[model samples]
Target chain A: AQTVTQSQPEMSVQEAETVTLSCTYDTSESDYYLFWYKQPPSRQMILVIRQEAYKQQNATENRFSVNFQKAAKSFSLKISDSQLGDAAMYFCAYTNQAGTALIFGKGTTLSVSS
Target chain B: DVKVTQSSRYLVKRTGEKVFLECVQDMDHENMFWYRQDPGLGLRLIYFSYDVKMKEKGDIPEGYSVSREKKERFSLILESASTNQTSMYLCASRYAGTGTYEQYFGPGTRLTVT
Candidate 1:
């Protein structure tokens, strides 16, 4: 069984600054996928970024990127130029090679201050 | 754009009542999932369906059943609602294709069992 852990329960970042949310997972499988998701007060889950375990290079979206360290079993999310809209609960997830349902972390509530 | 919609945004039910939560997707995805989210716990998969009339149990399938009579609609049922079952229920769908591991989610339905 794979388990994702987000040690931080709450985080705050000033507007236009950068923030990093930590995540770690335990899995024996060599082929897998890691993902970051955001949930706002609307309760809608949105995809932030994704990283393939086989890929050595990290994945970057508009303002969201992931530091995926396969050897360390760590996958952290970095949000640059953070805005008020980035204030939400962030979750880290893992999926097996078979594309099964994802296992998610407890989540880190990010509060972007103006 | 993929769109998943839940039947309700909020629901209130009493103990022992039978509750049904409906989910529909417009993307014609082959896989649909139901998950529950709590404050300290991340999203836990309750049930998933790969195709019509085919369902699979997830990590936490107890006290929950699902129906997928049609390809676009999936429904979750609580045979006997309990206070412990009260949480934000989320529905998601994903297209199983080459390199597609991201799942699109709907605005969750917050269920309160009293």
Candidate 2:
């Protein structure tokens, strides 16, 4: 069985500042995918960024990027130039090669203050 | 764009009532998933379907049932709803056998049981 853990339950970042949310996982599978998703007040799950276990380079999407350390089983999300719209519940997820449903962490609630 | 839609945004039911939550994806995805999101629990998979007429129990399927009679639609059922089941229900769909492993999610249905 695989499990993801998000140690931070809440976080606050000033507008235009940077924030990083920590995530860790336990999985025996060597081939897997890691993802970060954001859920806003609308209750929609939105994909933030993704990183493959085999990729040594981190993945970045505009302001959202991931620091993936496959050896440590750690995948963290960094929000650069954070805005008020970034306020949401962020979740870290894991999926193996079997294409099963994602294993999600408890989540971190981020609040961007202007 | 892949679109997944849930039948309802919010629902209210009484304990022991039969509840059905419907999900539909327009991209003809081969896999659909149902999950329950709770405070401090993140998202827990309840059921998933890989193909038409094929359903699999996920991490938590104790009081839940699912049906997938078509490729684009998946249904989650609670034979007897309980207050413990009151939470945000999310539906997701993914393409078949892909390394991308990106799952499109619905807006979620917030179910409140009294």
Candidate 3:
């Protein structure tokens, strides 16, 4: 069974700064995908970024990027120049090569302080 | 732009009542999913459909059922609602193609079973 773990239950960051949320997963499969999703107070879950397990290069979308270390089973999310709008519950997810349903970690609630 | 819509933003139902939650997607997606989100538990998949009239059980499928009579619509049903079933229900859809690991989510329905 694949399992994802997000160590931080709650994270606090300042506006215009940077914050990193740690996530680790256990999986035996070689080919899979990792993702970060943000759920705001509006109850909308938005895709922040994703990383392909086979890709050596990390995936970055605007100010959000992932440090995907497949060897260590560590996939962390880095938010550079964090904004107040970044305050939300962020989730780490995994899916296999066949595009099965995502397995998510316990979310980390990010609080952005001005 | 992928648009996924849930029938309600909030729903309150009594215990033992039959509840139905509707989800519709406009992207012609081949897969639809139902997930329940709880604090410290993350998002647990309840059910999923790969195609119309096809359904599969997920990690926590107990006390829940699904119907997918049409390609773009998926419904989650609670045969006998319980207080433990009170949580945020999220609906998602994805394409069954390359680079389609990302699932688009709708604004969730917060179901409260009293």
TM-score of chain A of each: 0.98, 0.98, 0.98
* True lDDT of residue A107, candidate 3: 95
Q: Give lDDT tens digits, candidate 2, residues B17-81.
A: 99999999999899999999999999999999989999999989999999998898899999999
What would the TM-score be for candidate 3 when compared with the true structure?
Answer: 0.98
Q: Which of candidates 2 and 3 reaches a greater lDDT?
A: 3
Models ranked on DockQ: 2, 3, 1
What tens-digit string does per-residue lDDT give for candidate 1 at A5-78? 99999999999999999999999999999999999977689999999898999999999988988989999999
Total clashing residue pairs per candidate?
Answer: 0, 0, 0
Q: For candidate 3, write residues B8-109 as lDDT tens digits.
A: 999999999999999999999999999999989999999999999999999999999999999999999999999999999999999988884999999999
> What value of lDDT does candidate 2 attain over all alpha carbons?
0.94
Chain B structural similarity as TM-score, candidate 2: 0.98
lDDT of 3 at A54: 87
Candidate No. with top lDDT: 3
Q: How does model 3 fare in lDDT?
A: 0.96
What C-alpha lDDT values do all the predictions have?
0.94, 0.94, 0.96
CAPRI classification of candidate 3: high
**DockQ agreement of candidate 1 with the native complex:** 0.86
How does residue B88 of candidate 2 score in lDDT?
A: 94
- lDDT ranking from best to worst? 3, 1, 2
Superposed model 2: Cα runs more than 4 Å off: none
